[model samples]
Target: MDQDSQLLQAATDFAYYPGSHSDDSATEFLNRFPLPLIINALQTQFDVPGLESALVACLERLFKTKLGASLIPEYMPFVQVGLQADSQAVRSLACKTVSCLLENLDNSHKVAAHLIKEFNMYPLLLDCLINGNEEVAAGAIDAIKKLASCPEGIDIIFPSNKGGDTDLGIIASQCSSLGRVRVLALVVKLFSVSTSAASAICSLNLLKLLEAEIRSADDTLVTLSVFELLYELAEVEHGTEFLSKTSLFQLLSSIISNNFTDSILRSRAMMISGRLLSKESTYSFIDEQCAKSVISSIDGRLQSLDTSDRDEFETALESLGQIGLSIRGATLLLSGSSPAARHVIDAAFDQQGPERHGRQLAALHALGNISGETRSENDIILDAEAEENLLRLLYEAASKSSKLTPSGLFLSVLQQDSEIRIAEWEL
Candidate 1:
């Protein structure tokens, strides 16, 4: 047989049983044919109905070897073309191949740069992610994850608004096509690109698209995935601040605090709250009703000692701490007969992981900020016991630790001297 026929047969055999092939045949195939020709043959073979999976398997196997890794660039054109192919199988095969190339190659930065600068493949990747088969869609998502990793690649995956690209907008409009898992993966992959990407995502109004899916989904993985995406988005300085302004924040807060929400999902929501509360300006934006719902969630989780959801519990404490950072929030939590202050106090003393320590510090900062609030003469937010509980917890924390480390913060010797004020919180 000629070299071309020999190469195709060998690949077919290897694809069906990677273990059946030896390095000898794979080496001979590469030695006889140029990378472009081999990639072309494989790309064309994807049209064969039953051979698609096997050919992809062969492509994956070839990419694992040194020769295959070096020739990744040769497959670039084929992949870009295949991404837009009318055949679902061809599109899926191309996506899987790109994922494999990115995974096996050491110089992915170069590969990614080639794909974006030379190939301009982001739209194709986005298209596959939106419309490809499940496994193929996942492969597209993986390619996106790689593209979002490097500076140049990140710029390509999440272009500035001037690019005249509307793929994200299309994804938002067609969100009903995305299930919860894909939705979570897409959001995470997009935000990881950059803070600027976060801004672009905000423009998409992505949360509105997924709102119903998040509310109605019953799977734990789905629930957890959605909330985690919310946390990731909220962590961004640009995205969640805008998101918080919309009723979306309140809706998520209510859903998360609901009794039926999974523990992990609830924790994810609490994380979003904590991130928003991280900023004093954003802290003020959380309205009273939203804060009340947040408080109720914290109280419910704190009371659930029967279920040792420590991570969720810690998250609740952190959210409550953020709420406490605001005067309005602190007053609500530390108000007369409110269990909020007591729960915050107990969380501060729990002595769990370093994570717990961070949560405690957040709670303490909220308390300190609350204690410093000078009520109007007619203000009645804090009664006698509330003041006493607030003072007592502060003094206890002050007496116990020589220094405070509240999630990257360090109180100075001067600030340490302020510990005496903990005892002075008498109303």
Candidate 2:
């Protein structure tokens, strides 16, 4: 038989149900076959639908063996070229073949890198992800998932912003594979990088879509992802500023204020609310938006600290301390008869672990800030007494662990308010 016929027969040997292959003939046939000739033939088949589809099938069969696996990555570009075929049938098969090559080349990252760099497989795979063909989309998902393991590959799979539609992420979401949980997970992974990744994803204004998901999606992964991204985004000035404009602060405020059955969600809401609203600068916004509800919700949560909800309890205390930094919030803290202050002080003194200590430090800091707030006409004496209680808490914390002394000593000067006494630090 001629060389082509021999290679064809060898591929056929191992192509059926890949279990317990009893022969080395597949490996032996691939090793003797000239790699350059096979690749040229595959490329040449691009315009011939029947030949290209058959050839891709043969390549898939070949890659099931050791020798073919070793050679496929090197010639992946020729296989990739078939993706441009006019026939959708040819295109779909090409995507599947590419996935096979990617699977076989997991260890050969350089080759995978080369395939993207040379053939621009990144955009090609995204098209597949968006393809109407489920088989092709599924194939591309595997390819994208594999590529994502390489960081640069993530950017390749996730589009960079080019000033397109604002809801690009959502638009793309509609085209994503069926049962889009994996797609949502991938989006979260991309957003984890930062705003750039967020923008690179759906559009320049990806946050709008993400916020929509956070507000509307009933899925846990989707809501949690939005929360996780929001938290991470808060770490950077750009992200935090973007979030502040959105109803994020309001959403978080509501999430904590409501009696959400999900304890973890409640805990996250409290932590995030405290994080975003704690700054004195944010006080005006909170006062205008959620002053009354913030006070009432945090107060109720603190009074009902269940052991199963200890995390939420600790987070609520932290939120309480933050609330004290603002005028509207400080009003709640300054009330001498309010159990909110007492709950905060009691929770603050707990030496259970480092996390609890951190929560305690937050409470002390809030009291310290409230002390410096110019008290209103009705509660000067009461505010002063609360200040004294705060100093006592600080001293107790410092005495227990000298490590806590720094947090005790940290101070901040609010823009609208005077200097912080317990010491102010903004994270």
Lowest lDDT sum, 10 consecutive residues, model 1, at 407-416
Native RMSD of candidate 1 (Å): 10.7
What TM-score do all the candidates reach, one by one?
0.55, 0.45
**Model 2, range 1-427, lDDT digits (tens) per residue?**
8655655554455354456442276555556666566556555645533444555565666665555666666666655765665556556656666655556645465566557657877666656556436666566666665665555665555445543332235544565323343345445455554555544553444556656766664776657756665665544443444455556666666676667546677776666666565554555433444645555677777776665565677677767766665554565564545545666555444545544545556555655545544445453344555556655655654566535562543421121122222333321
Predicted structure 2, TM vs. truth:
0.45
Top candidate by lDDT: 1
True-structure lDDT of candidate 1: 0.61
All predictions: root-mean-square deviation over Cα?
A: 10.7, 12.9
Structure candidate 1, residue pairs in collision: none
